[model samples]
Target chain A: MNLMMLLEMASQGFADRGAVQNGDQRLSYAELFSAAGGAAGIAREAGVEKLAVLDVSSLAVPVGLFGAAWSGKPFVPLNYRLTDAELESLASQIAPSLLVTSRDRVGSLSKLPDTQVMERDEFLERALGAETPTADWSMDPDEIAILLFTSGTTGAPKAAVLRHKHLVAYILGSVEFAGAAEEDAALVSVPPYHVAGMSAICSSVYAGRRIVQLPSFDPDEWLRLAREEGVSNAFVVPTMLSRIVDSIGEGAEAGLPGLRAVSYGGGKMPLPVIARAMRAFPDTNFTNAYGLTETSSTITVLGPEDHRVAAASDDEAVRRRLTSVGQALPTVEIEIRDENGAKLGPGERGEIYVRGEQVSGEYLGRGSSVLNDGFFPTRDAGSMDAEGYLFIEGRADDVIVRGGENMSPGEIEDVLLEHPAVADAGVVGVPDEEWGEAVAAAVVLKDGQDASSQDLQVWVRERLRSSRTPQRIEFRGELPYNETGKLLRRVLRTELAS
Target chain B: MGQLKAGSRLRSAVCDTEVMVVAAPAAEVELSCGGAAMLEIAAARSGDGAPAPDAAEGTQLGKRYVNEAGDLEILCTKPGQGSLGVAGALLTVKEAKPLPASD
Candidate 1:
């Protein structure tokens, strides 16, 4: 049966439970399915052959997404923050038959092509007003369902086509990882435009658990929602985690009692923040997930038990193991390869490649970035431990060569984060005439706590060798992170150069 | 309580100006004015819709200002300005006298 049936089964299974919540709005499984089915009819009516959905993270997006998929049209969600010029360029390429946008975003579409635009009001009038369609679970497993775009290092975005099978795998994997039960509720703050956000929404829907949708990220709002909604699970990034820790300070008193599971990924979670979170919320299970859009959100998860063992121990072995991303999840495989396409051994740093049923062979629309071997080269520099745990050193693009010494900026950032005054930090290699590139750091300090550049420099020197320490430290009110909470080190490099 | 009418219209006079307000709760409202020289609109009172200030709210006149464009000038309350004399309603362009047909 197709995914449409999954929703029907979930609705029947959890008819009485809350399926989705946004602010004061709530929709049960039955309500959500009915709404989705009705919306599907509206999408069919709108002639959305290949739907381009501009979604703000909300309960409405998933409902609309189901409708789009059921109607057998690929739903392409565009990042809402993109400039008008960028939107127009993408619109010209996609040439969507129907554009789904909120009323607030209607004005932004002035430059777009004259497609049939369905604003929020129009969506409600057509979708909610129509009768709920019957659940027959139409479409093939191989059929493309969603097209996700990756912001390229060169500036342009590449669209990754995700099929129904990949989505199914991602949802199933997350369910197993989180051990989602009907009693559980997931609070997702990630925007629906990204793979992580969309995957979380779909997984919660499939699990028939309650999902609390946060329209945007706000630390205080997140804490309040977790408590108020009694959220059991959440997917967060390290940056957001740092903010939450800062807002709550250190310990269980500032903890979320109902939050049983908290998964973080996107960028590397600093050891310090991970430790502090463990100490503060001893009852909560923290999981570190590693994946990309090409792999349908996550392929590996370092579970709570691993985090506890690592954080509790001062032993070098334990701390070293903590640096590694956990072993591949069920049905996922990883391989490290050098430039000549030769497989690298354990402890050898190279490009991290992954293969699985969840992992797409090639991107959907424009094809994937994967090579002929069916392994999507993650462009992440990493080494696999003898235990088979993946230890990511840095992005292939994040390498720093200072006086012929190759360095990973992630290493310096990790060391800097250990400092008490540094709340968040990112290191980038700045061009240097002598060293070819010099290590530079941009940091955000803990609230009301200021650290001089020399303070950070001395602190780093105490921990790492002089070569690994950042030669320059720049204090920032905030570090630049994308919607996915991934540090834009490329931006930091440019900032330092300027 | 009696079933609320599908639509309701109210007319209130402020400083000798009788303004007819159309209220369509939870629905979009469209109002057309008669014989006014120009029209001005106040942005939504609250980001989330909150009811307009009531009479007992002491007729707090918020800032009064005028929007001037070519051939039209509109006077209304500025943000956070609430006053009884506040012109929070719309105005229409006064009809021009019919121009005599040229030979």
Candidate 2:
């Protein structure tokens, strides 16, 4: 049940295959396994309870991840983008930890009490020089494998615990062992702290796909690396994909012929942007993956075929599925439930609930939130169509209750995006004296395009009911998006309310 | 025989085959590999007993074996010279329906 088992199997199955690469540096499966073993030795010698990485994506991520597993400790990857005080607070919580960071930050991080900060290079060198530890990872499924601090847009962050069994089941259920070709390379640009980043490492390793890391995301740089490294697959947040598409621009050649598949998730993707991307990379398979950190990774995927079918279909319902997150994975069961916990029928708006072996609804201090029947309330307002396509609206808290009718901002936003002039849009519920709330929108126009707020209102009114039209439309340069591509609806709501 | 549950690791005493339960029936059943009774990893006896001639087909690493009833399923953690079976009925390799790689 240990995560090391996946890496060990990969090393045994394809020891000579490339496992990880950063810039010009690369590590084969055999070398990565050896490094993990060595790192485990260092962790055991330091007697640290946990191994934490505060640096960007690098060789340290995989080494630290598998190393922690081999050492039987929960691996914690903190957001390096956090402010100094914020990072310090989190580091202190995991005291007596082996903190791995870049060389420049080592001096400052080393000052923390009960912490040992080592530069990434020094840690790797020492690990390479140290003796490899014996294979002694526990097989207990209850053992904690990772502690991911959920990116709370509203409150203080909490660590979401992922056990060995949960993660192993996720990988085993979704990805086949050695399924990838030896030539397949997956370009990963997400930060190591995110669940997608960690899952990419494990999934690529077990699937025998070589990982090419991008320390920071830049659309041009992503394209350059994809071409230079023969990257056949990649996982990007919607923001990254938007930028990549913009970089490709109109009528420009997307020189990445080797790119076969690209999966976008971590946020709600704007329809126009995805449509543009499909044209930009005509040969590449596009997937819209939807999940949360609590679900290990992606529980449902709008796969490649659906993307093409939806884009080409003339039917409104069929084309509308382009915005849906598609059906649940074979291992997962998804249900839309009312506030009373009753399962809702198709096309009924309610809370999204999921049940699966990979779903870990337990927080660090908070006990398990999973219901007695094993369903985990996702807190996301969404609905399912008759064919089982799941349409995710904004978070339940973001639902705009205007005169007691629950209205989904995503519905309004989608209509606005269909406008030819709109490039980006964010819809929120603003407090109103007359009604309980009113629908407000902030939109970014496409470059060189012009559209009045009246025109946009009519655009929605024509497609949807008059009540669904935006009461307040503010033209903006851009919508606020978090680093991971989630729209800051709370920020917009606050600004509009004031 | 003990009731098989998920996460249970079993090894064939008669051969080198080892498996981890992926899915199992709720009720206790006679599970055997290579025509010999399977023992839990913790209680497995160290032996290299020969496999029955009728069930000598070897197991493959990373492959899943399932019973005809679609209830009992085990993932081969280690390949061995003996095949997996239950109640003298040979298990078949479960074909994997490959999903698109989505991280």
Alpha carbon lDDT at B62, candidate 2? 77
Cα lDDT tens digits for candidate 1, A366-475: 56666777788888988887778888877877888899987777777777877888888889899988889999999989878888999889888888899888888889
| Residue A488 in candidate 2, Cα distance off native in Å | 0.7
lDDT of 2 at A129: 73
lDDT agreement with native, every candidate:
0.67, 0.90
lDDT of 2 by residue, A1-498 (tens): 888888988887799999999987789999899999989988888899999999999998999999999999899999987877787778777778999999888888887788888889988888777777777888888999999998887688888999999999999899998899989999999999999999999999989999999999999999999999899999999999989988998866697779999998999998878888888898999988898899999999999999999999999899989999988999999999998999999899999999999999989879888999999999999999999999999898889988888899999998898899999899999989998899999999988999999999999999988888889999898888889999989899987777
A168, model 2: CA deviation in Å? Answer: 0.6
Query: In model 2, what is the error at residue B64, expressed in angstroms?
Result: 1.0
Q: How close is candidate 2 to the true structure, as a TM-score?
A: 0.97
Q: What TM-score describes the B chain of model 2?
A: 0.93
Cα-based lDDT at residue A342, candidate 2 = 98
- What is the DockQ score of candidate 2, to 2 decimals? 0.67
DockQ for all models, in order?
0.01, 0.67
| Ten contiguous residues minimizing lDDT sum, candidate 1 chain A | A171-180
